[model samples]
Target: MTADSEISEQPIEPATDVRPVDSEVVLARGHLHPAILLLRLLDAMRQSVVTVVAGLALGLPWLLAIAAGMFLLQLGYALARYLTLEYRLTATELRVREGLLHRQERRIPLDRIQDLGFESTILRRALGLTVVLVETASGSGVEARLDALSRSHADHLREVLLEARREIVAAQQAEDDAITGPGTADASAADNSTATASTAADEPEWLVHRSTSKELFLRGLTDLRLSAFVVTGFALFEMADYLGFLTQMSGVARGVRDWFAQFDPVVLGLLLLVLLLVVISFGVITGTVGNLVQFHGFQLTLRGSVLHRRFGLLTTRQKTLPRDRIQRVTIEQPWLRRATGYGVVKADSAGGSRAQGEDTAGGWDVVVPLTRLENAFALLPALLPGLEREHLPWQRGSRRLVMRTTIVGVLIGLAGAAALWSTAGSLALLALLTIPIWALLGILAFRNLAYALGDRFLALQHGIVGRYIAYLPTAKIQSVVVRQSPVEQLLGLAELTVHVAGGSPTRLPDLTIENALELRGELARIAAIAAARDWQTRANATATRPPADRVGESQLDPAAPPAGDRRPWTEPRGDGPAADEDHDRPGGAPPDSSRPL
Candidate 1:
């Protein structure tokens, strides 16, 4: 039977209170809005348009038939999916069931939910529909997507889910306190604030940041890169060739060259310079227009624990990221942006993947896309409550790091010179000129390579022409490794890599071996404590569940101590090297090798 036939015609009403009285009772259950079918059909048509055009141009009847068949198949599948799909919201989990020939079901625990985002294309908006995306800590990016729901229903669902999650977390925290006495004063204060926030009839939202047209223009102006110009030139050339305009362009080029041939050398050089300037101007204008469209009417607001971002002109997007889910926040000041005193702030949450290009158009991780340097730093405290930009105790790497980088840069310059020797002959000597530039870059890099470890955060600063400062919460660190390459070992230096949930691992290169080990151990200890606290909360929550539903205590967390073990979580597990012991062998280590701790 179709979901529409089985379910009532009336939509599920929003819950007055999402707090759990019974775990198994359904809070809401409904099928996707009927408009989903139209959206799906439109998508199918869009996909087939190219095929249909190609078939018509090639005068191939069979190709048209194939395209028609594909369209029909897609329409049939969409119909089947719409008819079978149903979602249920319980106190403990959000359940989705769908399928016809093959049955499928998904049960996402309320506590694991990290984010709920809304998106609407021009078509969807006109139809009063929205797409809801659900994310978890599963690391596969979006875990579930509910397409084309009524806007009101989508908002109601988001509210229900977030409220339910908050209730669950609060209950877990109370249970934790019963066992562990009490948490830190800051945690207690946060819990109180959360409680106060939840008691309100409506969660008040405050506008945190808004991008003006001027800021958007500057963002695009400074977003320039040589790669963008090269790509644009290549694309234009290919298009000209494909459209049979290359010959015309070549004739024009020949005419211009012949005209220039009659001019003096200095005049030709000046003309060439003007042409280059014009090309650059064109690129910058194009880029600026693109950004203006993409970020028009951008706004960021804070509602309770979640940050809500809304932007885009043609396709409006609304992204909700919980402050607690943010694993890392990076402030980027590229050369041009730095020169303009502007910077961009991006965040990595446990809900999304970095491979998805979180900073690109249509992605949701940019907290502050563009702002003045001081303003950008000032906004961090709002996103990360306890962060103090000026108070961080930054520490630079050893001077050996500078020497090592300089040597590597010089070697690269020499290699380039050697590679060009045969082609450019005497002109190859110009390659050696890069050595001074490389040396300067090395010095700049060393100056930028600094890290600060705070009680609750780890801040890393690095880069040469640009500056990047990443702030990572200690509780979010999954693993810490100290790695020593052969050259690093010779220099008595090592690199530290800290792994978090959703983004690339953060690296601090060129630290003394002793320092690397010390930092690794400290981070590991902090992670262990966090893991233990998480375990206690989970265990307590599981205790209230039925025996069959409860998770196995020993399997709760690999990094956590086993259930009923009374040992302090901060103590070493004795599975690795001692803190005071030497990491190297009795003699010198082998060359061109590496090891991870």
Candidate 2:
């Protein structure tokens, strides 16, 4: 056939569903909104409240004007920043460019992107904007936060970025297979392309689950932080009085103090008891109400490989965690929640941040703040997909676990009683009551201690007043430790700890020494296998790239040097007819050692 006819006869391949990789594409640009500037201003003020209050305390008219000027300057700067903020997307990277005085460009590879979350404060949400937080597995607690994007745009961007990551992974797997050998028939590129096409097509996404207002309210009520907030609120109230904001209230407080000073011993005791009761009541009310506001309409949504959580009362927080990025899953059930058959499910990821208190804002993101135990169990498969769930054979602690715990609790109780003996005399004997209570606690804790080994996960369950179940992927485990104390040595019991990338290690104590050691070996073997597979996969991917010069196919050598020699692949060698053929082949020249061999 003539060249023109041959060209026309060759069928043209159809275009792919995915976009071509081009750095010039502007996926979305962030436009500054007045509400965003206002939110930023408020956040600044909240962060520097003490400085602002001090400036106000100077009581100078000029200071007030200066503060106003400063606020305006900050607002103007925020506006400028928002105007400069823009992001671009390519097949492999998400590029963010922003700066006023100095130019900055951030290019995050899609492969490194561990999470893509969309958060919105009440003001932003009202304005139809979302704050997109991009977390990479860089081992840095910091995340790239893009503010003032429309909610729809943010969601779309998140979807595109995640799909791009999946595409990259699929391409890499194909390359790896090409190098190593053919992959399974099911995992072929044609199948993958077809699946990608269907997914990219107009497939309606479904809502996985959402938290009810009642469930969130119950979560807030069960929050242990509620107890601590009582003290914080009292301190704030005292600060307000000291600042002269509540002159009338301060007078009442002084009057109460005077009344208390004049009370007899028995009356003073009764007043103290009443004060404690009042404080407890106040704490309960404040804590529960605060939690209710913070998690008013918490919702969990799933779209393919990503799980998104949207929550908040004042500052609506949205967290997106990739199923593969999750390092561990913890299910916590306090006595109260357990009694009501409710539990909280939390997930820890490699790129997650540590938060204080209940960690509602941290990396310990709550998958389900409050749900029925059975429902929570059912929800796990959805949250962490691709993993098989099985009923593992649990290894219960020995009876010695109970005895050891009782002895330790008794010692602690005795120490406390002895410390109080000189001050309270016979009344100190009342402290002895803690012994039985602690013993019962120890017994309950021992009873709850159990662990099971899954094919790819380690499940640990423990706790007394509260029940904790931690599921750790064997592949993510950094190390396993088996420790024994002197007492434990005599009893042949040990503690087993499984450490992951970040966060506290999950521990199962009072295991038999034999069992703990056996577990350690098993974990080590699994870790080794996982590491080897990753290494081989990476090498295969690297080796599968097409040669730069197609004319010199002979130059693409395939054999490795003998074990004793450490020569490079391109080094000249006498390796039989293959080497001679490479040297004499048409359109090929001798290997160049000067050029990096």
Candidate 3:
């Protein structure tokens, strides 16, 4: 109202900086396109089908009435999604406004956004529509999603989000204007800031990274994870047979059932043995074939915040996961890779849902394209550039002990095999072979297990079958544990487990006592830096604390977290924007993605 108001009326000057000051911001894409409505319609239909199927499975009484009810309900809901959902991207916020009679709205300020992921199912891809997932500040429980927009629109939206976030950060840092030297901190900060902003805009710069559709297809074709998924699918059916969820609907299952139904008591024992063998065989085939399918011709691209990967022949898919949503990054190579000087890169993204009780998400959205070991450093800034040091290395003591323990494990496994064969009979053939595979796997585990450090970066690479490389800031670590089992105790061995929010521990086994504690302390220090969210040095800080009642109402009570919860918060490293605006959210407010900052 004073001098500032009088100046505001003046004509604008062309300034170099286009950034914003507040940590909170409005979005860039606002109009709800028809395609987006179509996606909501599709989702409503799918949910309706699931509900109906569930009812039938539970034996709903009055079949015809139930069927009729389901049809009407589904149709009604789908129609509602089409008419009511309004996905919007504003200048400073991503807002979801919807309602039939009573409208509702939820907004996410760009600065608090952690990630964005694009997903395209076969149908959605055909429709040229994709989903944009947004990960928010709290890192757990609630998320916002833009259900349906064309692939190009989704990409553009990602860019807008990035730009907004950067503007906010720039404004916040306007005061001190602290600029670190170009040598170290500069590179790391630039990487994170760039990743955070470019995820959306990065795609446009693809003239430099343009991949042919064929390349994307081929990349998907030989993806080890897909192959692993296929193989594991078979195993899951076996597990389901044991626990009774999903089952093989093939002739073999039918034959087995018929035989069991018609068999005499004398044949039951034989039948049981056959079933057990089938399970073991399935597991073996799954493990082997999955390796073939998943990593056949893997290739990955790292340009800006987008990490693009494609692998699969029959049901091909290509994905571009923005760096901001990269909750955890991992690099893994079998000892085979050590020989080739090549490794696999897999990232933990926000889109996939976790199978309850499992260490990793059952259907995690992963990008597996073969990559170079050295590139690990190059990609560090984008994924997590706030690591304590310039470089992180493998825990030497742990690696050595683990390698030695592998050799010893072979000796013990052989002893066990001999005893087991004497008692269990010929089935022990597989167990006997385990002695060698274990030794080999152990050797590979030790040889392949490595952690590379880069300025403000920590990268973890391990595993043979299910290899992974995780990128995380020291700040992301919630806790560190050092434990030893009796066998390890006798051998002066211990295990170090660093717990990040909502992820399985990176277990480094058979480490010396001194190394285990040392590693823990080192990680903790890094975490301290990451958690250092001091705002004092900033020109300004803009934060959006949702209405208190709404925040409390929407959040998962921290007191009642998922069981065996690792992090005190236990929020995994995030969700994308797809679920950001939840006027139609099932519960009060969905959990903000549990993710790295």
Candidate 4:
């Protein structure tokens, strides 16, 4: 045996580090609790009911039989899956093995893990069970799940996995130090390493923000999803009407029909309008109650590098996001909330779906559900420390934005007018009257359109009835594009899109061509610098790393990138004719994000 292996067989002194190396440990096997079978059965019942209702609507007896058979099949499958499901975590990987006849297994590396979110329904909570969703940096949905784990086991697994990741990162750092020489690393790398070490050695910076019952209720009251509520009420009324007619037992419906038949067309229209108002009122109330339920007891806690969110009344949820994984931050205000000075702050990271049934899960994690504008601003620096001082003052877009938006609105109004003319005869000209209203909306949209840039970040604000302001570090941007349409070209206007990791591109429309290109070039340089800094860090880190770790490979792609290419940021293409070169033209600009509209 080798000297190291022989020495490992001996008991270490107490002064030596007792932490186990990742490769030397084997995680204990994990089994899904029997409760999973029960949960699956309940889910199957819900699906069965939906299937039966849909099938019954078709007036087909075979479909009912099929639905029953499907439910039974699903029940059996759930039982089988519960019996076969198994999970284990080793030093370097998480292993999940399931399936009976078709046997499936997945081995996810610890380094590949991006985040983990925990959830518990009312039923599951009562049973002391939780579901853990495992996500990777692939930007898709949850990659793996451990359903129906005991609450304690779930917590333990989370701690173990997170701790494993930290150990691996430390190992990588150590290897990098050996290769790059201690204290001689790149300036940026040294700063990051120092910050990480200091954070670990220092007292935990933990802050918890809780929403009071009064505030949460007010939040629901102000949500005001009027249109959604109207649609819901209408659907319920239609269903009730149809059921009454089908049973031939709806006196209310018959009376309504008779009353409607007695009224003149104009009077009937007025009554319908009144009825719409009543439905909308009911919808507003229902929406308010829904909002209350979803955000009740909302709490956000930041401990060290991870953020924790817990909320909901009927179904409690807990989500965990590492600050380092966050790619973008957004602040949003709907008209109702804006009037109340409330804003919803959200953070988008590389992976994981938001908690189930959390209405604010619009491809991001809601950091602050309903906070005052100032509070939202206060929370932003903690969530996005890199852009604290880098964001530029917001600048309004060009007047071309107003013209384009107004034109689009006018086209929509024309379509509405034609439809109304066909249906209401003499009332068709009313469509032209609506043009002013549409134009007002267009003006609102134009007023909200703005963009900002900083030394290391880019931000855009837009939306009409609701506003969304999104910001991301320039380094996190994946690509930049500037495009011009024929109409826009004539107006000397162009649109720019900054594509960031893990979220939709932030688009800034209607800027002068000079501004757009200038912005694009600056963004390209910033992104290139960030990319290069990260690349060099990786190169230094992996220089002494063992081949087994494959630290040089990308998180999503295991292959090493091509070498010896010139750095895009360092090129001298910033001067002269090359600067004016349009990417759409051959031998012009390099393939940027620009494309003809």
* Candidate topping TM-score: 1
Question: How many pairs of residues collide in each model?
Answer: 0, 0, 71, 0
lDDT tens string, model 3, 400-481? 5444556576667677777789887776555656556666766555544545333344455455554445665444466778
Would you list the clashing residue pairs of candidate 2? Answer: none
Q: Over all chains combined, what TM-score does candidate 2 have? A: 0.71
lDDT per residue for candidate 4 within 432-491, as digits (tens), equals 765677667667766677676766557777777777777776667788999998667877
Single out the weakest 10-residue window by summed lDDT for candidate 4. 558-567
Ranking by lDDT: 1, 4, 2, 3
Compose the digit string of candidate 1's lDDT tens values, residues 240-294. Answer: 3553443346887666556656889898657655656677888789879888878
Tell me the spans in candidate 2 whose CA falls farther than 4 Å from its real position: 1-35, 41-57, 60-73, 76-80, 135-143, 152-177, 184-206, 224-275, 353-359, 362-364, 385-389, 410-437, 541-597
RMSD (Cα, Å) for all candidates, in order, is 13.1, 18.3, 15.4, 12.4
lDDT of the structure predicted as candidate 4 = 0.63
Give the residue spans of candidate 4 off by over 4 A: 1-24, 49-68, 137-141, 183-205, 225-258, 261-274, 354-364, 406-439, 542-597
Question: Measured by TM-score, how close is model 3 to the native structure?
Answer: 0.55
lDDT of 3 at 356: 21
Model 2, range 370-486, lDDT digits (tens) per residue? 877655655665544322223345556666776776666667768878999999887877777777776787677776776777666677778776777777767777788899987
User: Cα deviation in Å at residue 173, candidate 4?
Assistant: 1.9
Candidates ranked by TM-score: 1, 4, 2, 3
